[model samples]
Target: MSSLFDPAQIGDIAVANRIVMAPLTRNRAIAGNVAGPLTVEYYRQRASAGLIIAEASQISPLAQGYLDTPGIHTPEQVAGWRQVTDAVHAEGGKIVLQLWHVGRISHSSLLPDGAAPVSSSSRRSEAKTFTRDGFLPVSAPRALRDDELPGLIDDYRRAARNAIAAGFDGVEVHAANTYLLEQFLRDSVNDRSGPYGGSIANRARLLLEVMQAIVAEIGGGRTGIRLSPLTTFGGTTPLDSDPQALYGYVVEQLAPLGLAFLHVIEGETGGTRNPPAAKPFDYEALHRSFPGAWMVNNGYSRALAMETVAEGKADLVAFGRPFISTPDLVYRLSHDAPLNELRADKLYGGGAEGYTDYPTLAA
Candidate 1:
């Protein structure tokens, strides 16, 4: 049986266990979107996790959606990430940076000179994003000109380089969560008539291009991508045609890349709005589509996670809220200890109150 504590390999990186720390965004970075000492301590405390996927970090100034979120496109940001990577490594832990580009989900208040967010098409997302003031409505983003697609791809490539320079073990492309990449992938948001719109293949072009650029820069084994097939956010409505065909085609295209791994966010992030109870999608069909390590997240308990791995349904399991309140989650799971509950009030935009205050089990 594959145990949760057993060592596993996700591409080139050798993870000590299967208890991955799923990326959780805590708006606690410095004013310039730089990782600070507090961020360092937060990751170091949870080094026991099999692998840690750092919070979503913007790849450019225009990618900023939430206030105080970290970035990787600047020298100061790289230096700040170095502090975090060094701290985690010192504790014998492995960490990966999640490169993000929030396209239409961004607000003008978060952009430089208060410019509108950019996307594949000029459409306004009906979603609200976090800002310095509070959660505010998103605005229509400027469409990326046909000549500018290459530049956006270059931005992702440069961000991958910066992540490596910051001493990260690898980089996971934030193609999920209705962000920039997802914006382009979804048909509802991408109504352009160019090569990047209409058919599923065209919609998937940007993600594949970005992946190719990152692979060219750091090889396929050092790159990973996250996807949320069933999520509906940021004006991302499900295609009435056929979702299985759309997502299956995506997985088939990505399978041959031989990338690090594919992380899937099963459903909603948290228990915010109750997701409609529908029959679960055919994961076995989708899992076979990607010929690489697979990590599953969302409302997963230890028992369920272990079962999924033992049954060969998933290679690894990620925990989001559990890690938020339990810094020593892996140890607790290994010993069958009770976990601490997370306080929702301090989840986002807070200092270190409930962030790094989770206590570890004494020896």
Candidate 2:
């Protein structure tokens, strides 16, 4: 029987416990996408998690979708992240960087030279993205040219290298939640007729290539990938035919790569969908499709997480909002302490007010 506070080994890193701090976007980075001092303090405070997956970080300038999100593509960005990783490690924590590309879910306010966002097809997502001003409507992105894919692949490789340079223990590719990789994987948005589209294998090529590039830069044991099989957010609309086959095939292909782990988001995060009704495709079946460690997240109570792990349905469970309000979530869970409520208004683009203000048990 595995407890949330019990130690576990994930890939090349030895975790302090089974509790993982899921990657969360705080929107605290400064200009030029450089992580600020506040960012360092925030992660340092939550370093007690067995493994800390840093916020969704852009792999390239074009990958920017929301204002103030950090990036790992620049030297300054790398140095900024080094400060964060150093602080986390000093607290005896292991952290992984999550590389992100938002694709059509981006707004012009966060784009390079005011260029439209890029995606597999020229389609506009009905999703709204946060900007410096406020939440704005996302624009239709330009279709990525065939000649530009190799460069995009290079972007992921460089981002992985940057993560290593930034003192991170590993990296997690963000292929979920209607981001760039999800945009490519979903058939409703990806209507390209080229080698990178049309068939399921072709649609999955870009994500596979990106994973390979990251693994090439960093060993497979140091690389992880996050995916959302039943995700429909950010203009991600999977064909109703059989998502099981598409995602099962993806896991099968990824199984041979021996990735560090597979992080899956079961369903909607900010919606009113019932958990029982929105239960994602059989996660255990999907876990079997992949030969690596499997982690499941989204609206999981402490008891539910414990039950899931006890049943061997998930090797590990990730907590998102609970971690935000409880910096010492593992300790609190261990002792059955009450968790502080997270203020919805202070989630994104806020300063250190709600970011690092959460009190620890010892404090």
Candidate 3:
């Protein structure tokens, strides 16, 4: 039977355990989308994790959708992240960067020169986003032309290369949480009539293309992707008759890619595992769809994580909010220590109060 402390290997990276510290957005980057000392200390404090998936960082300037989210496309950004990677490596921990591009989940205040957010179709999402002032309404996005997709693909490829240059162990494509990739994935939101839309294969085209381009730069062994099958996080409804068939086909297409692991958020993003009256889809069926190591996430406690892994339901378990208040979460769980309470007020766009001042067991 496998435990959370058991050793495992996801692609080329060898992890010390199966407890993964999931990517979390802290909105603490410095000017020019560069990570700084606060970011370094935050990750370094939690280096006990089996693997750390760093927060979502933009792949290009046009990819910015939040005030202080970090990026991997600039020389200064790379240098800033190099410090973070060095700190994590010094503590003998493995880390991966989650590359992100928020599509319609942005306000003009978050864009360059007040450019409108872009997505697969010219529809407005009923989602709100964080800005310098506060949470603001997301604008209706303009649909991307067929020719414009190639540039976005190149951005992902370059970001993967930059991750390597910045000394990260690997990179994970942020294809979940109703971001740019998921905006194109859900049929209800994407009404484009090109090769990039209309069917499961067509809607999944950009995601697969981006994966192929990144794999070309960094081998498939060092690359991975995150997927949310039934999460209507940003008010995205799947109008497709069968979401099971759609995601199953997507997973089948990804099987042969030989990427690292597929991170799946089982239920609603950042919410309960069993959402009441939600659309029903077989989790076991989705787990069996991908032939690679499957990572399970969303609303998991230490007991549940251990039980799921022991039952062979998943190869890894990722924790989100708990890690924010407990720096040594792995140790706390394994040794049955008490966890610190989370201060939700200081979660985003702050200095180091709730960011890095959390006490560990050592304190």
Best by lDDT: 3
lDDT of candidate 3 over 153-204, digit per residue (tens): 9999999999999999999999988889988888878888879989889999
Residue lDDT tens for model 1, 159-186: 9999999999999999887788877887
Q: Model 2: runs farther than 4 Å from truth?
A: 234-240, 271-280
Name model 3 segments beyond 4 Å from true. Answer: 234-241
Q: Quick one: ranking by lDDT, best first?
A: 3, 2, 1
| Winning model by TM-score | 3
What is each predicted model's overall lDDT from 0 to 1? Answer: 0.87, 0.87, 0.89
Candidate 3 TM-score, C-alpha based = 0.97
Per-candidate count of clashing residue pairs (backbone under 3 Å)? 0, 0, 0
lDDT value for model 3: 0.89
- Provide the lowest-lDDT 10-residue window in model 2: 270-279
